[model samples]
Target chain A: MNLIPVKTRILQKNENLFLFFIEYAEKNINRVIQENSVLVISSKIVAVSQNRIMNILDIENKESVELFRKAVIDEADEILVDKNKFFLTVKNGVVIANAGIDKSNSKTGEIILWPENIQEFADIFSEKIKKKYALKNFGVVISDSRVTMRRRGTVGVALNWSGFWGVKDERGTKDLFGRKLEVSTVNIADNLVSAAEILMGQAAECIPFVIIQNLDSGLFTNIQQTHKSAEISQEEDLFQISSN
Target chain B: MNLIPVKTRILQKNENLFLFFIEYAEKNINRVIQENSVLVISSKIVAVSQNRIMNILDIENKESVELFRKAVIDEADEILVDKNKFFLTVKNGVVIANAGIDKSNSKTGEIILWPENIQEFADIFSEKIKKKYALKNFGVVISDSRVTMRRRGTVGVALNWSGFWGVKDERGTKDLFGRKLEVSTVNIADNLVSAAEILMGQAAECIPFVIIQNLDSGLFTNIQQTHKSAEISQEEDLFQISSN
Candidate 1:
C-alpha cells in the first residue's frame, strides 16, 4: 500500500472541506482514485472546516494557567489526573490532555476544538467523494494527532470513520499454528489513520488529505457500522482500571 | 512519503534476518534504495531471528491459562493490572498487555518473546544496510503492534531504532500565528513505524520489511544518537500519576 499525499494550500477556519478535496483530486492528474481506496483525512482539517477554533485571548483573562485548567475541566467529560503541572482528562471516549483542545497550529491566542459532529460530517464527505470519484468501495477516515499515555510524541488516531468496516474480528480464527486466536480483533481504522500521518505530518506540512489506495474489499462498509471499535467503555478498559 | 513492501517467504525459527533483508533488497529492482531512506522492520522477525520462541509444553502442564499468567508475570518489570480475565503490565518502560509476549504468529504451543538486545541488534542491522546500499544517511526502526490504554485494536509502535534522530523537538518553535509551541516533540520513529504497517500488515502477509524514501536531511543521524525518546521515568509520567 502507498500513502499518496494530496497537497493543498493552508486551510483557513470554516473552509469547505468537500470542495478542497474535489479540487485537489482534480488537480492531481497523475494520481488516479482507484476503487477500494481509503482516503485518510486529518481531523484537524475537518475541525477547521467546521470552524472549531477558539480565541484563547477572548477568555482566561491574564491568568492563563488557572483559566486554562478551568476551561479543561469544563470541556472534559472526566478529569483523570489533576497535577499542578498538567492534567489528563477523558473527553468523547478518548483520554486526552486538556480535553483535546489544541493551541498549536491555530491562530495566535486561539485554540482549536475537535469537530462537534464528526460522524455526520464524515458520512456527508464520504458520499460526496463516492459520487464525484465514481467508486463503489471507498473508505473515509477522519484522523487526529494524539499522544499516547506512556509514549512521547504524536501519532494519528481515528476520531470518526465512514465508508469502511473498522474492525477485523479474528477471535474465532486460527493462527499460523492452528491455535485458536484470542484478542485478535484488528483496529483497521486507527492503523490507517497512522499511515495517513506519513503525509499529513504534525507541524506545518499543510497536507492534511491523504489517499490510501489498494485496500482489501472486506474493509469497506457504511458509516453506521464503521466506528464499532472506536471507543471502549471504562468498566471494560483494563488500562483505565490499572490507572485508578 | 511512500511505504513499499518487501516480500519474503515465511521465516522459520532462528532464521537469519540480515540474509533475508539483503536477498529481498536484491530482488526488488523496481524500487530504488535511496539515501536517507528508512527501513522499517517488524520486531517479530528480529525476535524470531534471535531464537526467542518458547514452547508452552516445555514450561507447564495442561493448565494453559495459569501457566501463561505466570510467564507474563515473570517477564514483566511491573504488573499494572492483574485481573482474572487479563493482565496489563509494564516491560522495559512501556505498558503492554501480557508483557508483549505474542502467541498468534508463532508455532503451535509456542510463544514469541520480544528481542532481548533490541538496540544493539538494530545498530548492527543499520550499519550492515548502510554499507550494502552505500548510503550516507539512512534509518532502521524495529516496530511492533501494540494496543492503546483506552482505544481498541492495535497500532504500530517503534520498539527500537537506529541510524537516525528519533525525536523532533519543537518546544520553542513558533506555530502558524508565531505563538510559542509546547509539547511539540514529534515521535518520528513511532509515526514512521505506524506508516510502515500500511504495507507490513498484522497477519500472515509475510511482508515483514518496509522501505520509506525521501525524508528530510535533518532526520538522519548515527546509531549512537538514534534512540532518544524510547523510555520515560514513571514519576515524570503524567499518565502514570493519573493512574496513581
Candidate 2:
C-alpha cells in the first residue's frame, strides 16, 4: 500500500466538496485513481464542506473557554472531562477531545466542528467521485485524529466510510494449524486511515486529502455501496472505561 | 509509503530473528533496502526469538484457561478484567487484552508472549540489520495488533522503535494562520505500524514482516539511535476511564 498525499489550497466553508476535489485533482488523479484505490479526506475538510465551523466567541456570549464548554456540552453525547483544560467527551459513539472541535489550521479564534451526518455524506461523495471517474471499485474514508490513552502523540480513527465494507468477519476462519482464529474481523479502513494520517499533518502542511493506492483488491466490497461503520457496544469494547 | 509484505516460512521458537530476516531477504532486499526506510516485524516473531512461546498446558501444569489466567496475572502491570471471557489487562503501562498474549496464528495449544525486553531488542535488531546492509540510517519497529475501543478490526501498535525518534513534539509549532497548534505532538511510528499491519495478517498468510519503503527521510532521527517510546500517564490522558 502507498499513501499519496495531495496538497490543496485551504478549503473554504460550504464549498462543494466534489467540485473542489475535481478542481484540484481533476487532471492529476485520473491516471493515479485506479480501481481498488481508497480516497481519504480529513474529517476537517468534511466539516468545512458542511459549514460546521464557527468562531469560538460565537458559540455563546462568553469568553472563548466558556463558550467552548457550552459547545462541547451541546455536541457531546456524554462529556467525559468537564472543564479546566480541554474537554474530553463522547460524540457519535467515539471518545474524542472537545467533541472533535478543532481550532488548529483555521482562523484564529475559530473552531471547526465535526460534520453531523457523516455516513450519508460519505456515501454521496463516493458515488459522485466514482461516477465521475467511471470506476467500478473504490473506497472513501473520512478520518479523525485523536490522542490515545497511555500512548504518546496521537493516532487516527475512521469517523465513517463508504463504498466498501469496514470490517471483514473472520470469526470461523481457521488459523495455520486449522484451529479457529480468535479475532473475528479485519478492519480494512482503520489501518489505511492511520497511514494517511501521517501525511495529513494537523498543521500548515495543507494536506487534508490523501490517496491510498494499491491496497489489496480483495478488501474492497463487491460493489455493495454501503455507507456505514461498525457499531460496537461498550460491553464489546475491551478498552472502554467503566466510568462511562 | 509502500508496505511490501515479505512472506517467509513460519519462524520457529528460539530462532534468531536477525538471521532469519537475512536468510529470507539477503538476496532480495539489499537492492531495495535504501537509507531512510523502516522495517516492521511482528512482536510474535520477537517473542519467538526470545523463546516466549509456551504450551498453554505448561503453566503450573494446569488447564489452558487457568494457565492463561496465571500468565496474565504474571505479565500484567494491572489486571483490568480478571476472567470469564478474556483478560483485559495493562502491560508495560498500556491497556491490552490478555497482557498481549496471543494464541492465534500459533501452533495448536501453544501461546506466544510479548517479548519481555522490547526497546533493547528493537535497538539491537535494528543495529544488526543496518550493519548487515552497511547502511547509515534505518529504523526497526516491533509491532503488535489489538482491537480499538468501539472500532471494528484490530489496529497496529508500535511496541518499540529503534534507529529513529518515535514522536515529533510539535507543541510550539504554529498552524496555518500562525496560531499555536492545539495538539502538541505527532505519533510518527504509530502510523507506519498501521500501514505494515494490514499486510501482516494474523492467519495463514505467514507475512509477519513488512518493509515500509519511502517514508519521509526527514522523520528518521539524525542517528541519535534512541529506542524509547514516549510515555503518557493517566492524568494526562484525555480518554482514560476513571475506573482504571
Candidate 3:
C-alpha cells in the first residue's frame, strides 16, 4: 500500500477541524483525496475542535493535580512535565504536556484535551464530506498516538471511526489446504490508521491530518463505529495500571 | 495481503525439512519466488532434520530433570510440561522450547532440540532453491511457535532467516511537513512472518510451511540478517537469571 502524508496548517484551538477541511476543499487545496477516499485525522485535533480542554491549574488542589499527573503518566506511557505546572507526554504518548497543551493556536493558558465526542464528530465529518462531495464509501478515522507497553515510541491508534469497515473477515474461513480457521479476523481500520500515522509526525511539521486513497474497497463493508468508552475496558487495560 | 496455509504430510523422526521442501516444492508449486518473497518453516522441522534429538529418561536422576525443567520455565514465558517429560511453549518472542525439544516428530522416547547451525542450513537451502528454480531474491525463515509471559496461545516467530532483508527501514526520512522521524523503522520480515503464522495453524492440518510474496522490494536493498548470538546480550539479558 502507498502512504501519502498530507500537508495542512496547524489547527488552532476551538477551531472546527471539519470546518477547516471544508474550507480547504472549497479552495481546491487538497484534490488528492478523490470522491471516495478516506480522511484520517489525529484525535488531538478532533478533541481540540470539540473543545475538550482541561487545565490542571483550574483543578482546586495540589492533590488533584498530582493525581491527574500520575494518571496521565500511567495512561500515556511517556511524558514530559514542563514549567513545573504543565505535564506533556511528547511523542512518548501522553499529549498533556506543553507539547499537547497549546497557547499559540489556542485560548490563553487553556490546555486542550482530546475531543469529547469523537465518534459523533467522525460521523458528522464523514456525513458532511460525503454530502458535499457527492461521494460514496468515504470514511473518517479519529486517531491518537499511543505506545504499547514494552515497546518504545508511539503509533497512531484509532479512537473513533466512521464510514468504513472496522474489521475484515471472520474466524472459520477455509485455509488454502481446506482446514477451517478459528478466531482469525483482522482489525482492518486499526491497521490502516496505523499505516496512515506513519505520515503524521508528532512534533514540528504540524500535518495533523492525512487523506488516504486506493485502499482495497472490498475491505469496507462491515464497519464497527463506537465511542472511546465502548472500545476501552477499565478492567484488563494496561494503561489503567499507573493511573489507579 | 491474502494468506494461504500450507500443509505437509506428517513427518517422521530424522526427517530433513530442506529435503522435504525440495520434494514438496517440485509438485503443485507454481513458482519458486525470485524476489521480495519469504518461506516460513517450522523450527521443529529444522531440529529434526538436523538430527538434534535427546532423551530425558537417559538422565540419571530426577534432580537433573527438575533443574532442566526450571531453566526452561525461567527462560520461556509459558511452560507446557506434558507427562512431566515433554515441554512446549507456544510463541513468546523467543524460538527455543522443551528448551527446544521434540518427541512426537522424533524417534520413540527421543526428544530433539533446535538445529545446531540454522543459518548454515538456511544458507544451504536458499542456495539449493535458487539453483533449482533459477531465482534471485527469496528468503528462508525457520520459525517456532512460542507463548509470552502474559499472552495465551502460540504465535510463530523467526528463529533464523537467510537470503532476505532482515530489518526494514530505519526512521530517518522526513514527514511531509519536514519533521524528522525517529525510531519508526520496523522489523518487516518478522512482522510478515508473524502475519503468515496466523494462517499456518498447528494441530490436525500439519501445515509446516508458507510462501509470502508481493512485499515491498525496497526493503531488500539494505538487508540486515542477524544470527542468534546477535539477538542475545550477556550483559542485559534478564532470562539468564539462573546458572545451569
Candidate 4:
C-alpha cells in the first residue's frame, strides 16, 4: 500500500468543503489512483464543510445550558470559548468543545448539527467521485478524531463510509490444525483510518486527506452507511478507564 | 503505508519464523519500499516463532485449573481444550487459559514463557534488519493478540518495539487555540498495531509481517520498556459486577 498525503489547505470556520474537494481532486489528485484505490478524509473537515458549527451564546442560559455547563466543568479538563461562540474542550476523549457545537461556521447563529446527515453526505461524495473518475472499486471514508475517555490524545474513527466493505472475516475458517475459527471479523475502515491518521497529525500536519492503494478490494461490498454508536459503550472500554 | 503480505508456507508446527520472513521478504516484497523502511511484525507470530504453544495434556489435573474452571464456567461463553492442558475461552477476552498457564510450544512440553525478554529480542531484530538492508530509519514491532477483561473480541497490543518511537506528544502541548493540552500525547505504536491487526485477521489471513512507510518519522521515539499491568479494582470497574 502507498500512503499519499492529500495536500489540502487548513479548513476555515465557515468554508464550503465539498466544493473545495470537488475542485481539488479534479485538478490535483494524481492519475495513478486507479478505480480500485480508496480516499480517506478527516471527519473534522467534513464537519466543518457541512457547516456543523455550534455556538455557546445561542445555547441560552437555560436549564440545558446550565446542566451542560456543569457537566463540562465537571467532566472536562480544559475548555475555551472561541470568538465565534464556539466552545472547545479536550475532554472525554473528544476535542469538540460543547460536544461538537458550532455557530461561526453555520449560516445565521444557529448551530448546524453533525452534517445534517452523514450517510447522505458520504453517499453523495462517493457517487460523485465514482462518476467523475469512472472507477468501480473506490471508497470514501469520513473520519473523525476522537479521544477515548481515559486514553490520551486522539485517534481517527470512521464516522461514515461508502463504496467499501465495512468488515471482513471467516467465522468458520479452519486454523492450521483444522480447528475452526469461532467469530472473527475485521473492522476494515476503522483500521485503515487509524493507520492513515498516524500521518494526519492533529494540530499541524496540513494533511486532511490520505490515499491508500493496493488493498484487497474484494473485501468491500459496495454499501454506503453509518456505523451505529450504540455498538461502542463506555462501560465496555477498558484501556480508557482507570480502575482506581 | 504499504501493505505487503509476506507469504511464507511454514510446515505445521515449525517454530523457526525468522528464516521464513527473510526468505519471503527478499523474494516477494516489492521494490517500491525504500531500503530504510520499517517492518512491523505481529506478536503472535513472534510467540509462535519462539515456540510458545501450550498443550492441555502437559498441565496436570491440578487445583489451579479446577479452581479457574469453576470461576470461569459461568462467565465464559465456550471453553476450548487443546492438547489436554490449555483451556481457551471462545470470547471471554482473556487469552490466558488456567489464568495464563501452559507449555506446548516449548522444548520437551515446557511452557515457553512470554518471550524470555521482549525488548532485548526486539532490539536484536531491529539491528539485524537495519544492518542487512543498510537502512537508517527502520524498526520492528512485536505485537500480541490480547482481550481486555471487559471488551469484545481480541485486539492486537504492542508487546515490544525497537527502532521506533513508542508514544508521541507530551502532556503539556498547546491546542489549536493556545490552551495547554494536558495529557494529550498519544500512544502511536499501540494504536497503529491495533489498526493493523484488524487486517491481519486472527485465523483466515496468514499475512504476518506488514510494511508501514511514509509515516512522520519525527513522531517515532523509543519503545516503551515497562510491562506494568493496569491495576483494576472490582469496585472501580463499572462492568465488573452487575447490581441488577
Candidate 5:
C-alpha cells in the first residue's frame, strides 16, 4: 500500500472541491492517479467548500464563547458529556466532540461544521474524480479523527464513503485452521483514513487530501454504498451502557 | 508512506519472533530495511511466540463453557458487560472485549492470551531488529483490532510500542490561522497499526507483519517510551461517565 499526502496552500472558504483536486493532481500527482486507488479526503475541506461554516460574532444575543456552545447543542443528536471546556456529542450516529465542528486551521473567528450530507458529497465527488481520470475502479472517503473510549490521542473515522464497500464482511470465513472466524468484518474506510491521517497532520499542515494505491481490485465495485451495513443500532450495540 | 506486507506461513506456538523476522528478511526483504521504519506486528503472533496459549478443557471441575467464562473474568481488569456470547472487559486500561483474548486462528481447543508485557517485547524486538540491520532508528508496534462504539466493523488499536514517541503532541501548536489547535495530539502508533490492519486481514490471511517505510525522522527519539506518556487517568478523562 502506498500513501501519498497532497499538500495544498491554505484552502479558502467555499473553494471548488473538484477544481482544487484537479489543480493538485495536475501540479503534483500528474499521471499518477490510477485505477484501484482510494482517495482519503479531510472532511474539513469539504465542509468549507459547502459553505458549512460559522462565525462566532455573527450570532445575536450571545457572547463569542456562548455562540460556539450553542452551535454544538444545535448540531448534536445527543449531548453525552457537558464538561466545562469540552462537549462530547453524538452527531450522525457517532460520538464526536463538538459534533465534529472544527475550529482550528480555519479563518480566525470562524468554525467549520461537519459537512452535511457527506454521503451525497462523497458519491458526487467519486463521480467527478472517476470521470475526470477515466478510471473504473476507484474509491472516495470523507474522513475525520475522534478520540475513542479509553484512549488518549484521536483515531480516524470515516464520515462517508463511495465507489467501494467501506466494510469487508468476513462472516463465516475460515481462519488459518479452517475454523469460522469471530466478529471479523474489517472497516476498510476507517483504516484507510487512519493511515492517511498520519500524513495529514492535525495542526498547521495544509494536507487535506491523500491518495492510496496498490489496493486489491476486489475492494472496488459499482454497487451503491450506504452506511446501514456499517451501523449497529444503539439497542443492538454490544458495549452499550444500559443508561445510555 | 510505503506499507509492505510480509506474508508468512502460519506461525507456530513458541516460535522465536526475531528469528522468524530474520528468515523473512533474508528471503524476501534482503536489503530494504532502513532507518525511520515501523514494523507493525499482530499481537496474536507475539502471544503465540510467548506460549501464551491455554486449553479450555485443562481446568479441573469446570465445564468447557465455564472455563472460557472463567478465563475472561480472570484476565479482565473489569468486566463491564457479561453477555451470552460476548464479554466486554477493560484490560490494561483499555476497553477490550474478552480482555483481548483471541480464540480464532488458533489450534482447536486452544486460545491465545494477549501477550504479557507487550512493551517489553516491543522494546526487545526493536533492539534485535535494529542491531541485526544496523539501522539507526526504527519502531515496533504491537497491534490488534476492536469494534468501536456504534460501528459495525473493527478498527485497529496499538496495544504498545517501542523506539519512538507513540503520540505526537500538538498541545501548543498553532493552526493555519495562528490559533492554538484544540486536543490535537496524533496517535501515530494506532494510525500505523490501523493502516497495516487493512492488509493484515483479520481472517485467513497469513500476513502477520507489515513494514512501513518513509516516515519523518523527527518522529524518532532517544527518550524512553512509556504508556504513561499516552494515557489519560480516569480522573482526567473527558469522556468519563460519572456513574461508572
Candidate 6:
C-alpha cells in the first residue's frame, strides 16, 4: 500500500469540493489516481466544503460561559458525558468528543461541524471521483480524528466510506489448526484512515486529502455490503457490556 | 508513506525474533530498510516468538465448562466482564477483550498470550533492527487488533513502541484563530499500526511484518520520551470520567 498526502491551499469556507480535489491533484503531479485506489478525505474538509460551520459568537448567550455547549447539544443524538472541559456525544450512532465538531483550523470564533448526511456526501464524492478518474474500482473514506476509550492521543477513524467494502468478516473461517474462527470481522476503512494520518498532521499542514493505492479489489465487489457489515449492534458492544 | 507487507513462512512456536525479521527482509527483496523507517510487528508474532503459548486443555479441569475461563482469569489484571459469550479484561493498564489472549491463529486447543514485558521486547527489537540496517533513526511498533467502545469490527492499536515518539502533544498550542488547543494529543504509533494492518490480513495471509518509510526523523531524537508519553492516567480518561 502506498499513501500520498495531497497538500492543497487552506480550503476556504464553502470551497467547491471538486475544484479542491482538482487543485490537489494538479499540485501533487506524481500521484496519478489508479484503479482500486482509495482516497481519504478529512471530515473537517468535508464539513468546510459543505459550509457546515458555526460561529461561537452566534451560539453564545449573554449569561453563560458555556459558549460551545449549545452547538454540541444541537448536533448530538445523546449527550453521554457532559464534563467541565468536554462533552462526549453520540452523533449518527457514533460516540465522539464534542460531537465531532472541530474547533481547530476553523476561522476566528468559528467551528466545523460534521458534514450533514455524511454517508450521502461520501457516496456522491466517491461517484464524482470515480467519474473523474475513470477507475473501475475505487474507495473513498471520510475520516475524523478521535481518541480511544482508554488510550491516550487521537487517531483517525472512518466516519463514512464509499466505493468499496469497509469491513472484512472472517467468521466461520477456519484457523491454522482448522478450529472455527469467531468474532473475526475487520474494520478495513478505519485502518486505512489511521495510515493516512501519518501524513495528515493535526494542525497547519493543510494536507486534508490522501491517496491510497494498491488495495485488494476483490473485497469491494459489493459496496453496500461494506456499509452494513461495518456496523455493530448495541448488545455486541464490548464496552457497553462491561459498563452494565 | 509506502507500506509493503513482508511475507514470510508461517512463524513457528518459539521462533527466534531476530531470525524471523531477517527472514522477512530477505523475502521482501524490494523493500530496503530505510533510515527513519518504522517497522510494525503483530503482537501475535511477538507472543509466539516469546513462547507465550498455553493449551486450553491444560487449564481446564474435569468439571465445569471452564472453556478459556481459567486462562482469562490467569492473564487478566482485572476481569471487567465475564459473561456467557465473552470476557472483557483490563491487563497491563489496557482494557481488551479476553485479556488480549488470542485464540485464533494458535495451534488447536492452544492460545497465545501477549508477550511478557512488551515495551522491553520492542526496545530490544528496535535496537537490533537499527544496528542491522545501520540507521541512526528508526521506529518499531508492536501492534494488536482491537475493537473500539461503540464501533464495530477490529482495528489495530499500538501495544508498545520504540525508537520514536509515539504521541504528538498539541496541548497549549494555538489554533488557527490563536485559541489554545487543549486535549489534542495525537497517537502516532496507533495510526501507523492501523495503516500496517492494510497488508497484514487477519487470517491466511502470512504477512505479519510491515515497513513504513519516509517519516520525520525529528520525532525520534528522544526515544525515552516516546514510551512515557503514550501512557494515559485513569483520571484523565474520558471513558473513566463518564463511568464514574
**TM-score, chain A, per candidate?**
0.89, 0.90, 0.71, 0.68, 0.93, 0.91
TM-score of each: 0.91, 0.93, 0.52, 0.71, 0.95, 0.93
Runs in model 4 deviating more than 4 A are A26-28, A56-114, A148-153, A229-244, B11-14, B30-36, B57-116, B145-156, B170-183, B221-244
Error of 2 at B240 (Å): 3.6
Worst 10 residues of 5 chain B by lDDT: B235-244
Which is the winner by DockQ between candidate 1 and candidate 2? 2
Residue-level lDDT of model 1, residues A1-244, one tens digit each, is 6667888887876778888887887797465587888888876778888887766673336666666666777788887777743667777666677777776787766777777777787788888878887888887878876667566677777877888877666677665555667777667777788777656656666787888877778778763754546676666567854333
Task: List candidate 2 stretches off by more than 4 Å.
Answer: A26-30, A58-62, A222-229, B26-30, B58-62, B222-228, B242-244
- For each candidate, give the TM-score of chain B: 0.90, 0.90, 0.73, 0.67, 0.93, 0.90
- Could you say which candidate leads in lDDT? 5
- For residues A53-118, write the lDDT of model 2, one tens digit per residue: 888753334588787777777888777766455777777766778888887876767788888788
**How far does residue A101 in candidate 1 sit from its true spot (Å)?**
0.6
TM-score of chain A of 3: 0.71
lDDT (0 to 1) per candidate: 0.74, 0.76, 0.53, 0.54, 0.84, 0.78
lDDT of 5 at A109: 78
Model 5 Cα shift for residue B18 (angstroms): 0.5
lDDT of each residue in B154-222, candidate 3, tens digit only: 334466677765544445665433534433434444444554544454434366777766545554432
lDDT of 3 by residue, A75-107 (tens): 444443332444435332222233343322233
- The sequence of per-residue lDDT tens digits that candidate 2 reaches over residues B1-244 is 6777787887877887888887777555556677878999888888987888878853324487787777777888777665454777767656678889987777777888888778778788888878877877789988887666666677788877888778877877888778776566877777788888778777777777888887777777645433345677667777656444
Q: What's the alpha carbon RMSD for model 6?
A: 2.6
Tens digits of per-residue lDDT for model 6, A71-147: 78888878777775477777765668888988778876677899987788888777887788787898788888877
How do the residues A1-244 of candidate 5 rate in per-residue lDDT, one tens digit apiece? 8988888887777788889987986798767689999999999999988889898853323487788898898998888877745777777766678889887877777888999898898999999889988999999999898887777888888888999989998889999889887678889988999999989988888899999998989899889887777788776576664324
Pairwise DockQ winner, candidates 3 and 5 = 5
Interface RMSD values for all candidates: 2.4, 1.9, 9.6, 8.7, 1.5, 2.2
Give stretches of model 3 more than 4 Å off.
Answer: A1-244, B1-4, B53-112, B221-224, B228-244
Listed in order, the DockQ scores are: 0.57, 0.67, 0.08, 0.21, 0.72, 0.63
Candidate 1 collision pairs: A56-A109, A243-B243
**Index of the highest-DockQ prediction:** 5
Superposed Cα deviation of residue B166, candidate 4 (Å): 1.8
